[model samples]
Each structure stands twice: as structure tokens, then as C-alpha cells.
Target: MHRLAPLVFPAAGTRHTATVIFAHGLGDSGHGWAAFVENWRRRQRLDEVKFVLPHAPEIPITVNMGYKMPGWYDIAALGLSAGQLRENEDEAGLLESREYFQKLVQQEIDSGISADRIVLGGYSQGGAVALFTGLTSLVKLAGIVGMSTYLPLSLKLESTYIPKPASANVNAQTPIIMCHGTADPVLPYQLASMSRDHLVKLGYPVEWKEYAGMPHTVLPEELDDVEDFLRKVLPPSADGKTEL
Candidate 1:
């Protein structure tokens, strides 16, 4: 697999072992979540955790009338005005994205980090892709953390996702944490719930949380939840499993 240039944020003391690759939302750079990441870095004392943020390549967005933007895939229409905005299904683009991030995961594994110690996470559009890729991952990741995100390729997941023999039944393994705002205007709450339910019906380990009155953004409480999740998934050290 080729290399992907990602914004690297090492542990509090330059320690490296655990890995977390976080993608940014549409039209936003990988650094878009810098401040949010800083909050977690300061609050958590994970000296061995390494954070990777990958910037999305610029692409034409259908909803924006083919205007170029940094998006994982083209959005056909927002359907907001007519309540019919829908993501443009780009099979090639989505598959390309999955390959790119999959390399990042393999990179960490090749560098001595165990597959189970690597976490995949993102926000909004990034979160959606993370779910799409992480769920279909051949290697079992520590967990998947998606905020304001929904499952993509719902119809194709079962058939397209190539799983390892050990992961033939992914429903019971590979825990997932999905958070959304009940009052979200961009990605409606119902859609998020539907995505969660879809996974639940498929028997995936999915945890859905709703934030009251929140919009298409993250809240402090939501950040807290993410931090809590990270702590629970990654061990503090190779031999130490205390606070993370």
C-alpha cells in the first residue's frame, strides 16, 4: 500500500504505539478538528497514543453545482430546500477513499502497532466514511467512533465488505459508537437513528447516542463521550492498562 500524508499528533511525550486516524468533515481540512483534538490531548494522559488526521482531496460536489471542495465523495444534492438532498453515489470515489485509509491502518500495523490497538474515527462526512471503511475492515480495529455520522453504502455493505474468516460474524465484534444531535439540520436525526438501527439489525456492536437540541456540530458532552470511549478501547501502555 502507498503512503498517505496525514497530520500527525504524537502522544503527550512523543510515545507511539496506539494509533487513531481521524478524517475531517466535507469542505474542511484535516486540521479542522485540531482544536477538538487538542482538548482531548490535554485532558487525556495517553502518552503512547498517536493521532493521525488525513485531509480529504478536493473534488467536485454535485450539490454545489460541481464546485470543487475537499470532500470524500460528491454530494448529489442537499435536498434541504425541497427536503430531498441526497448524497451522490460515487462507487469509485468511495472505494478509493477506503483504500487510502486502509493503507493508513496497515501502516500502523506494519509499524508494530497491533490491529486491536488502532481506532478509526471521524466527524460528519468523515465519520460516515470511517463507518463505511471500518465496518468492512478485514482487520479488527479497536473501535469506531463517529460523530454526526451515518452509515454509507447500506445496501452494499454485506456483499462488498470482505471480512476475514475470524470476522465472518462481525455483528458481535468490532464495537461502534455513533453520536448525533436530535436537532441536527444537516444530517437529520432520523437518518442517523435509521443508520444505527440498520447496523443493530445486522447484529453489529453499535451504540447510538442522541444529544438534545444540538445542531450539526459537536458538543462538550459529546467530546467527553469520545474521550471516554478512547480510554476504554486503548490501553494506557503496552504492559500497563490503567488510565488511558
Candidate 2:
């Protein structure tokens, strides 16, 4: 499959021992979230951790009257009300994106970063992909983050979704943080909460956070919590070891 090279932020510290790959939402590119890494660096946090921001492929979005945009997959429709997002999902597109993300993770592993030191995350449509990919990943990851998003192809997770061995659910115990806003109009808050509930029911340790009156956008407090979460999951290597 064809893919665009992701925007990479090299570790500011002397060595790179860990990595965080974050994806952007629909209509946005990797550049959209580059400031996230800058914010951490400004505070002298995660200086040894490299950040990979992957741009989603530009495709026609059905809900936007078929206009092409940077999206992980095609969204059939979206509404303020809950319960409609589960239908008409693009399964093939989702699987393709999952494969792309999995390859990115493998590249990190091949470069000497342990799978346990890599965290996968994303926002909105991208978040949905991260959640799906992390859950089905064969290699155990350090953590997973989903901001203002929900899980897709949720109904078929058990039967036809996950590949063999991965069906073993290697990252079942991996930490997962999901953040959402109560006033989100694109993907309703209820949808996100339901996705959280389903994952929890499936034995995943998912920490749910909600911001009152906030919309589809992120908030300062939300990023603060996410930063704190990253600190906990991808802390400095206890042995002070460096991959490169």
C-alpha cells in the first residue's frame, strides 16, 4: 500500500528511547498537531521521546457531500444525536488504515524501540483508528490515547475484525485514555461514552474524561491530563538506556 512519510520530531534530548505516534482528525494533517510536541518540549517534558505525526490519506468524505479531505476513513454520516455512528461504516478503509498504523509501529520496533515503549494515539476519526489498531495489535504497546473520538466497526470486533493471534488481545491490559466534550456536535458525547463502556466491558483498562460545555475541540485541561498520562506511561528509561 502507498503511504506518505509522517512528520517526525526528533528527540530534543541526547538520546531517543521512546516514541509516540499521534494521528489527526478528518480534514487535518500531521501539521495540525505538531504544536502538541512543541508544548511538551517547552515544558521540558518527554524530551527523550520522539513524536511521529502521520497524515491521513485524502479521500472523499460522504458526509461532507463527497468532498475530499484528510481522513483515515470515510464517514457515512454524523449527527448531534447518539447511536447513528455505528451504521454504514467503511470497513475496508478502516482495515487499511489499521494496517498502515501497524506498519508504523513495526518500524519503530525494528529501529530498536521496544513495543512496550511506544504509545499510539489520535483525534476524532484518527482516534477511532488508533483505538481499533491498538486493541487488535499483536505487540503489547505502552499505552493508547483517543481524544474526542470513538471506536469504529465496533459490532464486529469479536468475529471478523481482529486477525488470528491478535485475537488473543495482547494489549488488553495496556492503559487507554479517552477524552471527550459534552457539547461535541460532530461525534456526540454519548457515542464516545458508549465506546468507552464497550471497551471497559471487554476487559480493557480505559480511563474516561469528559469536559463540560466543550465542543469537538480540545481544551487545555484535557491536554494537561494527556501529558500527565504520557508521563506516567512513557517515563524516562529507568536504566537511562538510549536506542540511538
Candidate 3:
């Protein structure tokens, strides 16, 4: 259960005001998205925001025929239908990964980053973890971002798994943006929309973005939207100690 060191990009500015911890999809490492951080740096944006990209540990993937790969959790099955995707979910794996993400967030807070100034985000399987963690976080966060992903452990939301009490949920009012593609071949469009609908039913406000003719991948336009979200949640602070 050892984790690989995360790929961290220090804030370009002298002041470290905010943080975004983004996770990669299954079979991908933190290095897979290094260019994203570099791209924002090239534009001189989010210069005061530190980016932390954590690498998921290698584990046996059932969908890949037990092949070892970088994954946040084990997928028992993969299908074009959303129902098929939720079958035999690895709950233990999901919780373990959630704990790991929580630890990373705590490290940032310990380093003086306000809890409300930190965002938890990811893609695909990583996104699932982010959603789960953000929903169940003890501390309030600035926002949550999920790209081309669906909610995990959806069935347990009303159960003891998620603590049904309103006071127990710190992220109930946190901003969440979920982006999905209509033509996704891996995770169907229905999954994203249904997940959003379910969250709305549970009284969570979600900002959903749909892309036309896009697949299970990130587009430049998607990045632009994400950049805007980051700016909205993590605005520039005159002093690095600004608390939201």
C-alpha cells in the first residue's frame, strides 16, 4: 500500500495561496498530467496555486483480466451501460483510496493552505475517488472537479456509509463541476447525467458540463473550463493567509 511520491509543481509566485490535488485515470500516473500544470504556467495563470498530482498505486485490475496497473480502485467489471459499471464495486478499495486522498489534503492544510482554498479533483476512476472524498470530507473545501467521471458508491449515500446527517457532510455547499462527453465510449453519457441527477435529488448542487462529440478524454476546451473553475474558487490573495 505504499504510494509513489506525488509530482508537485510549486507556485510560480512567492506566495502559495491555494492548492489543487488532481488525480489521473486508471492505468495513468501523476506524470500523465504534468503538461497541464506546465500549460497553466505558460499562460502565467494560477501562479500562486500549487498543483499536486498524486500517482495511484499499482494494483490488480479485474476488468483488465487481473493485470496490474495504476488504479485508484479495482473495477470488477466494465460495460457500456451504467448499471454494468456499478456491479461488484470494490468498496474497500474505494475507501482506502479516499483515505489516501484525505491524507494528501491534510498535508496541504498542515502546510498553511486553508481548507476552503483547496480543491480536490480527478479524472475517470480518479474522479470517482475525488467525488466520494469531497462528498464525505470532514473539512469544507473550496470545490470539487471531476472530468469524464461518474459517482462511486452511489447506493450507499443514504446508508451509514456516508452519514446521512446534514451536519456530518461538510461539502454539501461546496461547488462541484462535472464535465462529461456525449460520445464517451468507456463511461456512457447516461452515467454522468444520472449521477448528477442523483446528487441533485440528494440536494447537492452540481454544475454539469456536457461536450458534444467528445470521447473519454480531456479536451483543450475542457481545460479552459477547468481553469475558469479554479479561478472562481481560488482567487488571488493579497496575503497568502487569506481564508475563505
Candidate 4:
């Protein structure tokens, strides 16, 4: 499979501390989240944190009128039935994306950043992929952010390729920040709650936020919330301070 081009934002200053890799939603590319990060870099002066945005390969969404969009998996229908969504869930695609994420993580690790300094996040379908990859991957990360997405019900968390005790402990130690607009039309707010419930039930610590009256797209306030979450999860370097 062809790898999608990744939009990389290298840490401005000399010492790199953390890397945040973002995945875009259906019909979107890595550029979708660039504006937010650009604004954040300016406001927070995040000169030591590297940011990466990887585009998903364009594939036909079997359910969206055969619309060929950037997606990791296909949705058989716009109106998702619990069973169909669970059954038709693309396990292979999920694994493939996980491998791709692992490659990115390894690249960062090879570049001198530790595994614990990495963060993964995304929106909508991208959010789903982030959660899936973050939870299943063997390496422990600093955090995982999911915006307007739900947990993948297809694979049992226990059946993940990574070992259980270590993976569970790592996930528990790694903070998960999930933000959802109350009025989100694409992925309902309830789904976000459902995801939280599921993760919590599985003994994972999660920080969830619900924005009032916001639409499917992210708002400025939400972006601020994300920054705050990132700060809390992936703190600054050991000099006792961070720029952003």
C-alpha cells in the first residue's frame, strides 16, 4: 500500500521534547488541522514540540455514494447500524494504520524523542483511528486525543496484538483527552460519551469535554481546550517551564 504524504512541523528550537501526530477525518487531508497547529505555535510559542499530520489514503467509501475520500476504513452506510458498523468494521485497515503509526512513532524515537513524549490525535474517523492505534500499539505514548469519534467495537481490546498487562498499564498511565461538540451532526455527542464509558469501563483514565452548541467543525474555544489538554498531558521540558 502507498503511504500518504505527511505534513511535518519540526520543533522550532534546538531541543525536541515531544511529538504530536494528528490524523485527519474522512474527506480531509493532513492540511485540515494545520491552521490550528499554526495558530497554536504562534500563541503558545511551542518551539520545542514537533507536530506531524499524516493524510489517510484515498479509498472509495462504499457507503458514501462511492465517494472516494481520504479514509482508513469504509463506512457501509451513512446511517450506521450498530451491528453493521461493528461487523463490517475493517480490522485489516485498522492494523495497517497501526503499523503506519508505529513507523511514525519509531521515526520520532529514532530522532531522539522518547516513546513517552509522543501524542496521537484526530477528528471524526481520524479520531477513531487514533484511539484504535494508541490503545493497541505496544509502545506507550504521552497521550491520545480523540475529537468527534467513537471506540472501535470490532476488535476486543484484550485481543490486541500488544501484550495485555503492559498495554493496559501504559494506557492507564497515558492520558486520553476527548472533545466533542454537543451539536455535532456527523458523530453525535452521545458517541463520544459512549467512547468514554467504554474506555473507563476498561479501566482507562479519560478526560472528556463537551462543547455547547458547536457544530461538526472545531471552534476556537475548542482549540484552546485542546491546547490546555496537550499541556497537561505532554508537559514542557525539564527546565521547569514551557513556552506555549
Which candidate comes out best when scored by TM-score? 3
User: TM-score of the candidate numbered 1?
Assistant: 0.89
TM-score to native of every candidate shown: 0.89, 0.95, 0.95, 0.91
| Deviation (Å) of 133 in candidate 2 | 0.3
Report the lDDT tens digits of candidate 4 across residue range 18-129: 8999999888899988988888888765667889999998887887687787887877665364455677787777777778888988998887778888999998888888
Prediction 4 global C-alpha lDDT: 0.80
* Residue 209 in model 2: lDDT: 92
Question: Candidate 1: how large is its RMSD?
Answer: 3.4
Which of the predicted structures, 1 or 4, would earn the higher TM-score when compared with the native?
4
Query: Per-residue lDDT of 1-244 in model 2, one digit per residue for the tens?
Result: 4457999998878889899999999999999998877998788788778999999888889988999878899988877344566668888899999999999999999988999999999999999999999988889999999999998888888666554665577787999999999999988888899899989997889999999999999899999999989989999887757645
Lowest-lDDT window of 10 residues in candidate 2?
A: 78-87
State the lDDT at 103 in candidate 4. Answer: 92
The global Cα lDDT (0 to 1) of model 2 is 0.89
The regions of model 2 sitting more than 4 angstroms off are 80-82, 162-167
> Mind sharing the TM-score for model 4?
0.91
Comparing 2 and 4 on lDDT, the stronger one: 2
Q: Candidate 1 — which pairs collide?
A: 76-88, 78-85, 79-84, 79-85, 171-203
Candidate 3 error regions (>4 Å): 242-244
Order the candidate numbers by TM-score, best to worst.
3, 2, 4, 1
Preferred candidate (lDDT higher): 2 or 3? 3
Could you report the Cα RMSD, in angstroms, for every candidate shown?
3.4, 1.7, 2.0, 2.8
Assess each prediction's global lDDT (C-alpha) against the native: 0.80, 0.89, 0.89, 0.80
